[model samples]
Target: MTDRRGLLIILSSPSGAGKSTLSKRLLEWDPSLRFSVSATTRAPRPGEVDGKDYHFMAEEQFKHDVIEGQMLEHAHVFGNFYGSPMAPVQAAIEAGRDVLFDIDWQGAQQISNSVLRDFVLSVFVLPPSIAELRRRLESRGQDSAEVIAKRMQKSWDEISHWDGYDYVLVNDDLDQSFEKLRTIVTAERLRRAQQPGLLDHVRNLQKEFEEISA
Candidate 1:
């Protein structure tokens, strides 16, 4: 098959929704998909590697990059700033390698509305129920009760923007949701606009037909 332009696969969800898990599964399913390493002013959590997990930066540096228009999309979340760097994403897509983003609603909105909007595919994941969302958050054991409470409070705000995404999935079953996600990606990759090389193939076919007719 001829190569196609890469996609900016934006996956967003409220905290404790299955976006992160789905993103991980997606990358595992297709190793060619590059994960967009977002820059964040927040300190790295235990076992998180710099540049790999996130491009952890000081608040000053983060603001400087944003001012310089180096960030593709940025948002303030949890009292910290986070954004995707434009350079790597541009390079990856130009090379026909899809880039996966695990960001929040604000970031996804910005990217989807950007000049590169044509290449964007945004998906929003919703928890099956409020209780399940809270349970998932608590099961992680990564945050305190107060933090969980704050996330719960904010989840509704995130869910309200679900309609902005191209696809929305209630992540009640991990396997089923993943299959749907995979199908969406696979189909989007075959869209006519994505496959520039198809034109060349069509032209060649036309040439062959013309010679046969002659």
Candidate 2:
């Protein structure tokens, strides 16, 4: 039987390192996973849907949640309000489905520090190099030089903290990186800490073994 304590998979990478793309791919490929939609004050872009792409709310509403302790982890990034809402994530976890987090190290640390350690597994994705990161960001063609420079600078800060993650995968090749991440997720699901019924399974097997010996 598959392990069933469920999971909180944190996928963090600086912009253009492919964390978001990999996360989306993982969710689409794995039926047992449910993507965690973050709550934010940022307005939705064209072709982005509320509650699906994100739980877009006003800054006032987000601040209310933060004050009321309704957020599992919330942070201010690049002058925007962003947070992982408690209710939906909790509900998903309790239902025995994996919940994916496309959040930064700070938010991940907060969740881990709050004693939700057993359910959380964090992975840091790294680009091949600073040069490759720059090329990839430029290839996206979505940002101005100033914005890209900001992200490249931010990447230096984010990538320096790679040691904090449970697993680190370098994205030199997309297919290989995807496989590595997939394997980690599957392996984590089998960890004894997350498998609630492991003791029961062991006990039942022990009984059978003793009966045979008798």
Candidate 3:
């Protein structure tokens, strides 16, 4: 049996950069990959489900979890607390199941610096251009004009962290970007360090070869 460790795939992008769409396609491409559901202190919006979209938590509880070191990574954004729970991530990786995270740069930084940093593969998605990003945000029509402006204003802050990621992809075409994303995942999974079973497998082969030579 080939032993493998799960990868912590973190995908980040400013709103409307097609991160969400790429994430959906990645999940569809590989059902074995698990999504890392985040915990948030913000109220659930319409159509959002608890434990699905987020594990909606109270501010106090969220703070407590952070203090207790139960969060793999966390941040306060837009006045709300958001975090990835540590336990599930630890569990998934041990079971050799890749865990995917759709989070911001802050959370990605936190995870990249965590104890399990070796397992993380962080990717940053960028729009082809700021103007195109604005157009996509506007086309969504889910936010008010004021909110869209605010998002655009903060987009630079997000883009500034592009260098922090292991890989950065400009989402000019969704299909092309997704293909690259898949290739990254596939290559990461094949790393020698990830295949712990290879050591034993090689040892067995050596013994067989020695017997044949004798």
Candidate topping lDDT: 3
Candidate 3 to truth, TM: 0.92
Question: What is the C-alpha lDDT profile of model 1 across 110-214, one tens digit per residue?
Answer: 999887899999999999999999999999999999999999998999999999999999999999999999999999999887887899999999999999999
| Candidate 1: segments with Cα more than 4 A from true spot | 41-48, 57-69, 77-80
Collision count for each candidate, in order: 0, 0, 0
lDDT of 2 by residue, 99-210 (tens): 9998887887877765467689999999999899999999989899999999999899898888988899999999899999989988988888878778888999999999
lDDT of each: 0.92, 0.87, 0.94
Encode model 3's per-residue lDDT on 54-167: one tens digit a residue.
999999999999999899999888999999999898888888889999988889999999988999999999999999999999998899999999999888999999999999
Off by over 4 Å in 2: 1-3, 42-47, 58-61, 78-80, 203-214
- What TM value does model 2 have? 0.86
Q: What TM-score do all the candidates reach, one by one?
A: 0.89, 0.86, 0.92
Q: Can you rank all candidates by lDDT, best first?
A: 3, 1, 2
Candidate 3: stretches off by over 4 Å: 209-214
TM-score of 1: 0.89
When 1 and 2 are scored with lDDT, the better candidate is 1
